[model samples]
Target: MEYMDMYKKWLEFDEDTRKELEGLDEKEIMERFYKELEFGTGGLRGIIGAGTNRMNVYTVRKATQGLANYIKKQGIENPSVAIAYDSRLYSDRFAKEAALILNANGIKTYMYKELRPTPMLSFAVRNLKSTAGIVITASHNPKQYNGYKVYWSDGGQVTEEHAEGILKEITSIDYSDIKTMEFDKAVDLGLFNYIDDEVEKDYVELVKGLTVNWDVVERVKDTLKVIYTPLHGTGNKPVRRVLEEIGYKNVYVVKEQENPDPNFSTVKYPNPEEHEVFTRAIEMAKELEADLIIGTDPDCDRVGVVVKNKEGEYVVLTGNQTGALLTHYILENLKATGKMPENGVVIKTIVTTEMARKIAESFDVEIMDVLTGFKYIGEKIKEFEEKKDRKFIFGFEESYGYLAGDFVRDKDGVIASMLICEMAGFYKLKGMSLYEGLMSLYEKYGYFVEDLKSVTLEGIEGSQRIKEIMEMLRMEPPRDIAGIKVKEVKDYLKGIGDLPKSNVVQIILEDESIITARPSGTEPKIKFYFAVKGKDNAEAKDKVKRIKDEFLKHVKL
Candidate 1:
């Protein structure tokens, strides 16, 4: 049917949706109805409005119906599912809609009673022995966006095989054939079960148990001055509970952003990767004379940190810096205490800093680099568990995602915050701070710096231009960047190492710097990631500017 006919059908919607539709002009209608919102491997994400291209009850119902069919195919004896939602607008409504559709199809759903983080949903899937899990969140996207993500029974985001199977079901099923049962009716029939309090307690305990150095935690539990902000999402309760329960008495919460607000009115963007999101926490840290500040994103899967530098001023550490620091901290403690596993392994994404490799080698541990995404890291954990050759210790991406244990297959900001606090406390006991510890690592590992630049080209033309840019680079590979020789190029689409095929390119320079270019899987943007090591910070900064400027001249973006 044409979007005009669909527009007329929307007339039967509630007053609010009807008003929105009535206000839209022709161009607005075209943009909203140009194409259906895609169901990518990770799942669906889009602006919340009234159209096939938007995220709404209709899209939720259609996607859930597809997922329900896929779940039935898994052939579990009981075949139940776990459902969770964040603090996004209509997230609760979407969760209920998914539950009702699953129940309508005779599959049971364990839905959270309130908003929860992404990692919790992953844990809930395995804890309940369910067929799969659904998370109604867009991670750290802006206020107008919401999303649907799926996790398999292994507690990881669905792998490629599962995603392909689900896509087949989604494409074959017509939107009209999607069915839904009323939420109340499903509950009364015992098809929808609200997750109990014990489940949350078990998850918190699981995180607490993953702490490496309890002695260090106890030594500075009271003196560890830390500030945390959830950025108006789902991290408020669990993050605080884990910290306070672990005996961090001096922990302070950014009171203004502690509660859930769909608008995220306090910050320009709710992403933890953006330094501006820590504005409120930085202020609170300064007033309280805190040693460290932590900020989690909307879903609490990514965390950002601010620590007092030697100059007695606070500085926001980039994700690479924090990952390297944490890597060193975790490994040093393991080796120092004789707890380091003989076959220990640490995993990082391709775009992450190479300082990880240096740290792992210093401990005589193996390092694995997967394509971008925590799911790949999770895949390695499952592989190691089966092979029984290596023990998983730490995993992280350059995008502020990190995982230490296999309890959750995705990044756990809750645990990452705890570990960072503990790491800081250990440094404090040694008469230093995390910032000073980071600088020490630089001194040991030579100065390593990274820079990422994203060129967002939205809509149809932007996408075409992105393709053209990638093709241009592939066809005419750069022989030199900023007078530095390009040693070789690795195209991941043809498969690299033991990794699966992907549309990513790595330009290895003679100086050992790495330049990676890949299109964003979910959004309409192309990102360029640069990594370089130098004798000091200034040389690294200069190298980045020269390489990036030369690279951009070839793209015409």
Candidate 2:
């Protein structure tokens, strides 16, 4: 159908919705309707707009109906699902509509009474033994976006095979025939139940158990000055509650971003990975002379940290650096307390820095590299559960997502917040800053700097352009990058990489610098990850700048 025809369909909508659609430009309508919102391996995520191809009530209903149909086909006698949403616009309504649709199909639904983090929804899935879970969030996306992430019984995002099955079922549905009942009627009929505070309490208890050195926490609790920001999302209350419960006395929340705001009123982008997002928190930290500044994205899945470097200037650490610091801190503490597991494993994505692998090997802990998503780490937890041979220690990705324990299958910023504070306390006790500790790690394990660049390709044409770029790169793999001889190439989509098939490619240089390219599974963008190592911080900084400049030249983007 033409975009103008879709615009006419929008005109047929209710008066209020019609007015909203009419106000949008032709370019906006074309972008929204040029292609249908896909059910990829990461589930559904898209720009919020008025079209069957965008994330709206109609699309949400169709997705729910498809998931409902899939559940019925699986022959689960009493299918039930848990639904939760974050603080994004329309998230609550979307969650309720999804629940009502599922209830209309005779499926039981457990919905959160208020806004909740994505990890809580995962926990609720297993706690309730529901067949599936739905989280209405775009994770770290900007305010104009929203998403629906599906989770399986194990509280992990659906695997490729399962997602494909669900996609098939979704495609089989006709948008006009999906049934949706009134939210109040569904609640009255006993098909919808609101989750209570007991679940939150249980989740808090589980996080508190992940603490390794409560003695240190108690000793340095009052002395450690910590600053935290939730970036105007769901993390504020939970993160603050957890830190307080753990005895962190001087924790300060960024006041402007403490409350949930769908527009993310303070920051240009809600993502914690960006340094600009930390402007407010950094200012507050400077005022308080805090030891560490921490921030979590909207859904509270990824975390970012800023600490005073050796030069006494506050610097934001890359996700890989943060992960390395946390990994080293956790392992060293465990060893000091004689709590190191014999068969422990540190899980990370293939694109993550090799410095973490080196650090893990030093402790005699196994490092397992999986594909990009954190769900792969969750899958490993399930594997460890089935086979008691290996123990899961910690997991992280290059995009600021980290998990210390298996309490929740996905990344929990609440857990990361607590552990980061504890780590800061331990370093402060040693009279060193987290940044100094990071430099010390680099001094001992070689200085490593990692950078990620994403190229956004919007709409249908953009998708094809992304595909063309990937194909071109695969066909004409770079023989050398930035005067460095290309030593090896790992092609993941062909399953012939040095690792496995993962829709990623890694290029090793003669100087041992690394570069990897992969299209993002969750968004309409291709990512380039660069890593360079040097003997010291100064040399590493120089090498990183040169490599990053040359990398862009090579990619010609």
Candidate 3:
């Protein structure tokens, strides 16, 4: 349909939608209806508004109907779906909208009574033995964005095979065929049900059970001062509960950011990876002399940490630093307790720090590399479960997402927050803060530092420019980066090893530094990931700057 036609069609939906479209001019109408919001492997994400290109009730309904059709095609007995939502604007309404649509198709749905973390939705899919799951969240995106992410029975986001199938079903759907029933009517028919707290209890128990060093925690539990902030998202209750249940006595919550706020007024962006998100938490930490600070993003799937260095100044730890520390802690504790699996393995993305590989090697464990995205790690976990040859120990991406256990096949902030607090306490028992603990690791493993830089290019012209840049790099590859010889170039578009094909290119330098360039799957940006090893922090920082500057010089943009 043309933009004007689609605009007219949307106006026929209802009064509210018409009102939303009332003031839109031709340019605005074209922006809204030029194309349908894409349903990719990770599902739909867009600005919340009334349009075919935006996230709204109609889009949600159409997606749900397609999902229902797919479920019916599978022939699973009494197929059901598990639904969860974060604190984003209209998240709850979207969840309910999807549930009613599913119920109208005679497919049952179990939804949370209130907001919950994305990981809990993953767990609920497996715990309830449902066929699939949906989480209404935009994760760390800005306030104007919202999304719907689809998951399979294994609790991992749908990969290529499943996503293609779902996309096919969705494209075949029509507006008239998308069905929905009254929420009350659906509930009375036993097709709509609320997920109870017992399931939440089970999730918390599993996270608590993954504790590595209880003795260290017990010794410093009383004196381990810590502060946490949820950034006005869904992690407040679960993160606090796990810490208290594990006996952290001096834990404090940043009061202003404790509750859910859709606007996320405290920060410019709700992403935990951004240092600005920790402003309030850091203030509380300094006043209280807290040992550690933690912040989780809106959906509670990613966590960021802050700790005091030897100079008594608070500094943010990059995702690589945190992952390396966690890797060391989990491996060391396991070996000490004589529970280290003979086939244990740690998984990381191609863009993550290579320090995890060194830590795994030191402990006689294997390290596996996958494409970026926690779902690939989750996919590896499922593979491990089915193969029985490799035991999944831990997995993380360089984007502040980590998973220590297989109970939930997603980056779980609830579990990562609990483990981080415990790690802090464990080090405190030895008179060392997390910064000291990290330095200790650097002393053992070579000093490895990683940096991520993104260039945002918006709208239609920007998309073409990004594609051109990637093509230029692929066709006319750099001979060297920062005066060093380029050892090899791995183009992921041709399919790297057993991984699926993707539009990514990785350049390996003679000095073993790695530079990966890939367009962001969820955002309109191309990201450059650099990993370098140096004798110390100074050299690493210098090498990162030189390589980053030289690499950017090649791009015409």
TM-score of each: 0.97, 0.96, 0.98
After superposition, which runs of candidate 2 have C-alpha atoms over 4 Å from their true positions?
A: 1-7, 23-27, 496-500
- lDDT assessment of candidate 2: 0.87
Query: Model 3: per-residue lDDT, tens digit, 1-557?
Result: 68899899989899999999988898888888988788887799999999988999999999888889988999999999999999999999999999999999999999999999999999999999999999999999999999999999999999888887888899898788999999899999999999989999999999999998788788888998989999999999999999999988998999999999999999999988888888888899989999999999999999999998988878889999999999999999888888788899999999999999999999889999999989999999999999998889999889999999888999999999988988888788788999999999998998998998889897677789999989988999899989999999999999899988999999999999999999987777899999999999899999999999899887754
Full candidate order by TM-score, most accurate first: 3, 1, 2
* TM-score of model number 2: 0.96
Clash totals in order: 0, 2, 0
lDDT of residue 108 for candidate 1: 95
Give lDDT for model 3.
0.92
Give model 1's TM-score versus the native structure.
0.97
Error of 3 at 3 (Å): 2.2
1-557: candidate 2 lDDT, tens digit per residue: 67788678767867866877877787887777666688976888887877867889888888989899888889988889999999898999999989999999999999988888898888999888899999999988989999999999899998887898888988887777798888788889899999878888999999998898888898899889988999888898888899888888899988999988999998888998898988888888889999999999999988999998877788888889889999999999999999999899999988888899989999999999988889889999988988998999999898898998776899889899889889988989899999888878988899888877889987778888888877776788778766778888777787853543677877888898988888887788999888899888788778877877887776677
Cα lDDT of all candidates, in order? 0.90, 0.87, 0.92
Higher lDDT: candidate 2 or 3? Answer: 3
